[model samples]
Target: MFVPCHQKLVSAFLLLYCLHLSAFDFLWPCPQKCICRQDTLEVNCSSKHLTVVPEGLHISARRLNLSGNRLKTLIRRQFYGLTQLEELDLSGNIISMIEVEAFQGLKYLRILKIKNNRLKIIPVGVFSGLSSLLSLDISKNEILVFLDYTFQEMVNLRELNAGENDLVFISQRAFVGLQSLQELNVDHSNLTSIPTDAFSQLQSLSKLRLRRLNINVLPNYAFRRLHQLRTLQILQWPSLETLNSNSLVNLNITSLVISNCNLSAIPYASLRHLTHLIYLDLSYNPITSIESNKLGELLRLQEFHLVGGKLLRIEPGAFRCLAHFKLLNVSSNRLTTLEESAFHAVGNLQILRLDRNPLTCDCRLLWVMRRRFRLNFDGRQPTCSAHERGRRREFRDFSEAEFSKVFICRQAGILERKLQDVMVDEGTNVQFECKVDGYPQPSITWLSPQQTPFSSVGRIRVHANGTLEVRYAQVQDTGTYLCIASNAAGNDNISASLHVRSSSRNYTPPNFFDESLVETSLPPSTNSSAQLSSPFPFDAKTIVIATTMGFLSFLSSVVICFVFMFLWSQSKGQIKHTATIDFVPRSSMGGGGEGGDTGRFTMKLI
Candidate 1:
């Protein structure tokens, strides 16, 4: 304690020097070309073009990024000093070989990324001691196979991304100890089929993506053991054709997407088991139709999407009983008409996307026109087909009154007058013409005198233009024939009598314009009283006059009924009647359907 003053000063200087060396130890020996942030404890040696792992790394470095380097192989104890490192990225390297225990002392490493490398095989014990690793990304590599117990030591790994690899085979126990893994991605692999045995080990997997695999069929119970899986996406599988009905048998997923595949129809049977499914996307497949009762079992389904396919028609009741269904997108298909009954069973549909389709503007779309303002079209309103009067016009551009007028659905009516009686000799050919018109082009049906329907077979034939042709008229064909034209609106009919005489009798064809010759041309055996008692005594002019009067009467009756309904609707205050044609603005309505107005307009009769 009684030292000299000069000696005390020298001792104090030595002590200060030792403290400075210990405090700046991690900063002085930093790698030559690497940037070391002492405050954050991060060392970045990326893109340095070094052929080996750099020396002089700090012992307490928490994150080390050595990506985009030229390191060829990872020898044992390559990172033996960085015991506290939490994240290590060795991506974009040429590391093809790794010795056992290469990562021996990284006890607290949580994330390891070694992607985009040229590693062809991973020997056992490559990841032996990384028990605390939470994520491992080995994608974009040339790994050919996954041997058994490859990742058996990473017990706490929760995510594994092995996509974009040349993987063709996976051992049954490749992922034996990864019980806590929740997400796995193996997309763009060369696997020939679903590795069911390998996948069955991941009992805790919640999301899986298997895209662009060289596989054809998804066998039954492929994912039966993935009970905790909630989302499954199988995309860009060009060779995938058949999805067995029991493929998703025991799954409880909420979202399933199978896009860009070779599916020719909806896999209804395969999807029937996912009763809790909420969203389904089957876009860009060759599906042609949505059959009835196939999707009715998915009562909890909310969104159904089938865009960009060869969908020509959706059968009636296709979306039946889906009470919670909200959105349906079938845009860019070959659909001509969407029937009103298709959405009759849906309880609360809000959006319907039918754009880029060849939609015919007709009565089948009347229901859509009425609810154009109420329903959301996803900002891409549907346009009419080129054949309609309002070609390429958006549904939102037309007012309700204008739409009703342009897209009229009239009852079927025969254009020609009553057919004249025909007196032909036996073995002669006869024909009767029936021209009709309607909005939907009613179907033509021919009925023989015996009340039996005549088809385009045997001696009787019905032509495409609504013509009834008799090849060889016989005596049995000497009765009244009827032609009926019918559609959803209504039906119309016309009748004509045919008199076929025996070939032996001398007969002269009567002129239709000369009434006297028509009356006298009857066969002698046929009684005059019976001929005069014919109910069709009207001439051509008279028949024309009667048809015109009947049409006028029908028009008046329709007007009267419409006026009565309009008055009644106004009295009940359920619908808003307008004296002039005007668009129903969306802002005027309350909650789409809560107000008295149902977003429809009525034209008051003058």
Candidate 2:
């Protein structure tokens, strides 16, 4: 406890020096439960459970955050002395009323966020002195209508977000003075139609989002005045059904998204004028097919997405002349097959997303299989449906050597063993069966000896079962008929000869008359060479060979049937029954399937 006088004096001097330096640091007062950074002139008073704005804020504060608080009202000249304030955040508050002159002195403020508030109506002069504001967010509010000249004072405003509000009516002059506005968002509103008159004033707007509106149709020239718009998104309009032919006539947009709508088909006519479009997304629509030549006008389109739709087929030449196309995502669709011709014009495709589709593994998809490694699947590889082997498998599971085996295709083959030549009397009904089979199910067409194509019309008709029926056989119908079956794999043809004899002549059937019987039935004067030609021209040796082959085929069929029955009976006898009980978790029970059963007794034979 005893100290020398020299040591005590030195300690006292050091203590006073430290106190002097701390005095200058405490010149600016920071309110309780608030953080004030003097170096950056920023103050954060967020989520402090404060009832009123803190007093004695730093004069040089350039940024202030009062979000997530209980502040209900902003009085006149609330922040009068904070002249250097550039950014102010008052979001996530219970602010329902703001005086007209509350922000009258914030001339330097550039960004103001008052979103997620209970503001019912924004009076005309509420934002009177925020002339230098560049961005304003009033989203997630209960604001009803935007009266005329409501935002006229924000002349230099560049971006405005008024989404997720109860906005129903907007005056024509609501956006009269926002000349420098570049982006606007009015999503999730109750408006029934596009506010064309109000949008015409935003000539400088480049990006616009109008999602989740109650509109049902997009009328012609809906966005004609938005000449400078480069990106437009109209998503989640469930009632939207029709897009008029001239809806997008004057738009020069490069990116467009119209997803999650009730669009039954692509609005090809409406998109015909968007020649400058580069990215297009029509995802989550009920579009069943993409017809040929409909989207060819979009030559500059590079990325296209039609995900989660009812798309069944992409016809040949559907994407013709899209040389600049790169990315295509048609995932989560009901597509059975995608032919090579569908992407013949899209040679430059780099990223393909064909996953989540029931694609049939066939020759039509051979082109995709060959380039599987070179193309980017975007993390979701394509999967083949159960059409081939009753199980789904990803395309990457197959190797180059399995290409021909997995993606198999057969050329059309006639089911009949041989084409039957027929001789029918005139006026009798004549029919020719040309049943054929092939991968992708070939289409049948008939051609007469005169080179005339026959269809399901007039006296000659091609039935749905691939049978060509001629109601009344005439002399013109006599001759060889060609039945052609064609598909993507290949084409096959079979010919049948038909002879129609006149009804005036009486003749014995060739098959019924034996060689000896024909000679006796004919007159003695008629020469043997002149007798009707025998329909059956088989010799004794030929008859024996045919009979032996028929017997062998029948015997082989019987043996195979017996073997199948023996195996089935043996397997059935070996099965043993075991009583098992399974208890499914509540999480699994929510699925409402057999596997999700709460409690089940599985009786398996052991």
Candidate 3:
């Protein structure tokens, strides 16, 4: 095996490197109770009931989790040798104090979480060495106040959460040097008032949440320095009642929510400067009225919520200049009447919620009722609140009768009527009556078959009972006749057909028979021969014709009775007839009657 000299030297160097790596792996020391993974440079000493940081931790560890422990204090130089530590989690511990130089040597630390601890105050210079810290969470602590320059050294801090604390005040310059800070959440704290300069140095902050505080009034220029703020939420401020005009006069926030503030009215002047505002929520207030143009300055506003307000009325043009507005929620109010012009300016509204209001459902609110299908809102239908009767009924449940009663100031309209056809001989007179039921007793007018006014026609006459009588119903009158009934409200019409027949002399009147003949009549031999003599010139066939005609008349009488009963049933007993009608068959008209037997029909009045 003759190898080159350079190959031999390389082989020796490889063996030495392997030995050095093994020695380094075996020499790294781990704390007795903690588990260390040298490959990942991570350590977990959680839930060990450890009172202090164990010594001799691996210097290569980057993440050290010491949560769920009994550690009471974080002493100075606790992590002296672990300069490469990036994350330190001391959450769920009883840590109350953090001494100076506690994080003295870790310069590259990026995240530090001390949540759910008993920390009362954050002393100055406690995080002096951690210049690369980006996120710090001290939530669920007993922190009372934020002293001046408390976070002036963390220049690269981006997110800071100090929520669920007992913080009462924040001194000016508390966040002086946090140049890269983006989100600051101090919600669920006891903050009474925020000094004007508390957020003066937060030039890059965009989102600020200060909910559930004791802030009573927002003074002038409270948040004027936050130029980059886009979202501001100050919710659940129990004592907050008033806001000055200059409080938020300079910010360019897009979303603002000031709910549950016990406000009586909208601070329109304070919000007049937010031209770029889009979403505004003033819910849970006691606002009674909405004057016109109250929120007209928010041109770009899209959604406006005023839920649970005691709004009684909204002046016309109140929601005027919102060009891109879409949603409006004014539910749970005390509105009695909403004029049609109230929503005349909101052109692009897509959603509207007006439930739980004592709205008076009348003619003025008909416009909203017409658009009920487009505005799909939840809850029961709105009811009328004008008088006692109006209160018992919902607007959607109105019937024709109910509407007539409520809107009685209008004119009359025909409700019920009948138009029956009449038949008469050409020389006889016939009448047609249009009996109608209306409120104001409408006037009646008739038009002849030629469309000429009945009053102008010589043969036609109108009666006081709305009946039109034609003295002689000639063949020309055998067409449709129109009857018009009119009043102030409106007009209605009905038409009747007149069927005229040629005059027939064979239709003779029946003579009275003797009572003795009807009770006990003898055969036609001697006693009745004189009474049965023919009056017209006829042969023996007249007897057969008369007997047949008598039989037919009997059948016709039965048919007429059936027809009369049917008409009575169909009319429901509301018939108002001045005369009765009788139908006679063609055979009853003797031979050589006028106008040959048409074999169709001839009407008669009895």
TM-score of every candidate relative to the true structure: 0.68, 0.72, 0.56
- Candidate 3, residue 570: Cα displacement in angstroms equals 99
- lDDT by residue for model 1 over 445-472, one digit each (tens)? 9899989988887778998898999877
* Candidate 3 or 1, higher TM-score: 1
Question: RMSD of candidate 3 to the true fold?
Answer: 33.1
Tens-place lDDT digits, model 3, residues 354-437: 767876555556555666656545545666666455676665666656654563323334344565688887667787777765
RMSD (Å) per prediction: 33.7, 26.7, 33.1
Model 2 regions more than 4 Å off: 1-26, 344-346, 387-391, 413-434, 443-484, 492-606
Order the numbered candidates by TM-score, best leading: 2, 1, 3
lDDT of each: 0.88, 0.88, 0.80
lDDT by residue (1-606, candidate 2, tens digit) is: 999999999999999988965763576578888888877888999999877889988778999999999999998889988999999999999999988878988999999999999999998888989999999999999999999999998999999999999999888999999999999999899999888889988999999999899999999888768899999999999999999999888999999999999999999999999999999999999999999878888999999999999999898988888889899899999998888787645469899999988888888888888888898999998998845652488888888787777788888888885856999987778889999999878889999898788878878889988888877677678999899998888999899889988774653333434566444643347455644565667656789999999999999999999999989988877654587777765763455555654767778764
Model 2 gets an lDDT of: 0.88
- Judge candidate 3 at residue 570 and give its lDDT: 86
Candidate 2 global TM-score: 0.72
TM-score result, candidate 3: 0.56
Each model's number of backbone clashes? 0, 4, 0
